[model samples]
Target: MNADAVPGLVAVLAVTVTTIAIGTWGLRFSRTTSDFFVASRTVNPRLNASAIGGEYLSAASFLGVAGLLLVGGAEMLWYPVGWTAGYLVLLVLVAAPLRRSGAYTLPDFAEARLGSTVVRSACSLLVVGVGWLYLLPQFQGAGLTLESAIGAPRWVGPLIVGVVVLVNVMSGGMRSITFVQAFQYWLKLTALLVPAMVLLVVWLDDGRPGSPSGSDGAWSVPVAGEGAIGLYTTYSLIIALFLGTMGLPHVVVRFYTNPDGRAARRTTLVVLGLLGLFYVWPPVFAALGRVYGRELVAEGHADVLVLELPRLMMSGLGGELLTGLVTAGAFAAFLSTASGLAIAVSGVITQDVTSRFVGERGPTASVAAAFRLAAVIAVSVPVLVALLSTNIGVARSVALAFAVAASTFCPLLMLGIWWRRLTDAGALAGLAAGGLGAGGAAVLNLVGVEGSGWGAALLAQPAAWSMPLAFATMVLVSLATPSRAPSHARRFLVRLHTPEVLEQAG
Candidate 1:
């Protein structure tokens, strides 16, 4: 009886065991801070690409995107497409240079490029904020999965994830996380792909080839807005997803693990392909969800659309077995993304906090210990937030996080890499403007100022306007206060733009 819950539990347990085992195995190679922070700068392009794909495909992509497509329709597909295409933007603009800078984290880039500890500390604060924002959904997704699959209480999933993640992140940092994420990538892809194939067969056998009734026509078409609010929300989302990837801390940190600029570029390209393949399935589930998952929608359970499909479509133990597989995949999404976020934020804290006391203390410092300590702090905030916050759709929460990242950090990274004249004063001012602008809007949204049309538009998509203001402030402020510019700006530019081999040989 109720084998649906049983098989689901088995699959979840199997995936969890595999993830922990891989992370433990990786600890053997992680000997020093360098290994923990950036994998000793030796991870090959192929495996690094897989790790990137795994970590990048967060709960938003796995569960949220599909749910959005089910609820909102074709406009939602752009989210995944934009997210993956962001790598191309990274490939052309910042991937190689960021990797070649030999910076383990974003703050390191700020300090090295601007030569200002003030700028570095500001960046550190932003990194921790964005990391925690990104992490809340991962923990929430975990809670949702356990509730649906195992009949567990609301808090159980997040608590389990928080403890497990703290253990993995503290054990080995980036070195260990790299292997864990790479393994989870294939597990996630397989988990989604297999159930999808079986579901497709079941749908065909049932002989309902046309569009689902409720989601047909208007709902299925691109830019087919239910109202003006939907239109503005869609366009704003497109902007946030397209521009936000460059600013994501965990995503940016992976570049530092590559051996050279060329490897970094290659890694981004492979990640694009892996992510592209994985994205194809979410829409499939979302579309079928429109048909088979109508009840979930009525019950306001859209995020669980992927989990509920098997039991709804197929009878007997086969459906339960398939639900188990999808359950495991969802867990992989949560674990891999959460682990990467913890590592990125913790690395920033460790580097920044210890730099205060030791001023680049020699190799003997307990930098690894600092990183482990920071990992605890990094994961703690989001867990608390997730527990306190009301449950929202996975995609919406993620988009809000993206809006925040796109507003604050995206401008900083773009200008830091390209605009040689940017000054420390300019950066700090821009960061303040963007953070306040976007953060204020997000807070309003949280408090439910979801007014219709333009009012809703303003709160929903603050980035398109806020990003420009931040960039303008940086340029104006930098021009107004050129005296604060770093003296070594030209030399830093050369090092950042040059190939890794050229820098080493020079």
Candidate 2:
């Protein structure tokens, strides 16, 4: 290995070992499926918040944010701002009620709320779809990180990340991950924070570099272009990031770890704080990259700017050490997020798919056996997709996943939680409308499909239209099929809204 490769390679290995060690420590507590699935609902707010931040950061937040700002200009700030704000929406609308529902996965919530196996199955499929869509970038981002940091073959990174996540997840499940992810959150924050501070010092020491646009009045605005489509794209992206957080399978599952509805809300508030603080660092990297790392933007390697910025500004051991630190954090970002998604996907598959064949054996047997089987499927599908396709910018790929979530589950959760009249027919209709409309556009965009004029903008960013359409379809269909409403809808809503303390007293 070259001299520069040593620190990065060592960093990756160290993080992998640390993650597995933390996960193994959690195995002692995971004595039951309930523990594996939800940490026995005992995770405290602070720890739970940290784990949520770790899992939610993903490659997009860690690598993609700075990269987007580096190349896409200030308009991309919405991605981070909206991502942080998404939890606020969750806090006010869904967090507490969702925790009180006692559902393990989104499908469980559907069945518990809608009282329909059909709606449950539809939710299960969408969970897997969204989970897989989200996982695609974590794996792809892993490849890009490794190839950039150590000059490894593009395929090598995904394989390593996949195997590591598989072992950590199947070893102890959610119980294990709560500790592992919490630790990763701090690790990621420090990794980004330290380098940013030092880089800012160096830039100031060299006399502040002007914005890369060279005083052309660029970097002054947060939105790109003033054309009709540009305006549409900005609003559409904002919609996706703002609404999508509540819908992410991995993110929603974290709430299930909180002990009660109140704890869930508190955890979300803490998560908002943590996310807000971490986001502050990425823009620093973007600004530094604009000044010193322009070559990467020109060559389409902007995603590695955070990893490379250390070396660009500081020479010798200082640069190498910082690179190693950032590299460890980047790897941790993938591990934490991938582990969370794998668990989310596995839980859904175990409950909805694998249980059918083995459920007669009971929750103990089915949860154990089915969970193991599901983990394999959860990690495998996305790894294959990452390998088969070309690399898109990590943040943009994540944005696509956000658009799908915003389009589908955002409507489902908002309407399902707030609206009493939601029916299985309506839920299914909305899921189909949102999933196909946004998901089709995602697939087309991924495969290099394009269109001229407004069609391209809509396809490239579908949430603006798709989310509203989903909301409308669900409402209209529910009204049309009032007879298909769950007979227990009001009681379920009551269950969701009631405080855990009050419910327990009764």
Which candidate wins on lDDT?
A: 2
lDDT of 1 at 405: 82
Question: How far does residue 476 in candidate 2 sit from its true spot (Å)?
Answer: 0.4
State how far residue 159 of model 1 sits from its true place (Å).
0.6
Report how far off residue 187 is in candidate 1 (Å).
0.6
Candidate 2 residue spans exceeding 4 A from truth: 208-224, 357-365, 504-506
State the displacement of the C-alpha of residue 179, model 1, in Å, after optimal TM-score superposition: 0.5
Structural similarity to truth (TM-score) of each candidate:
0.94, 0.97
Model 2 lDDT tens row, 96-211? 99998889989999888888899888888988988998899999999988998899998988899999999988888999989999999999999999999988888878886485
TM value for model 2: 0.97
- The per-model lDDT (C-alpha) reads 0.84, 0.90
Model 1, range 111-212, lDDT digits (tens) per residue?
988888998888889888888878988999999998899888779888888888988998888999999999999989998999999888888889875654
How many collisions per candidate?
A: 0, 1
Output the lDDT of residue 475, model 2: 98
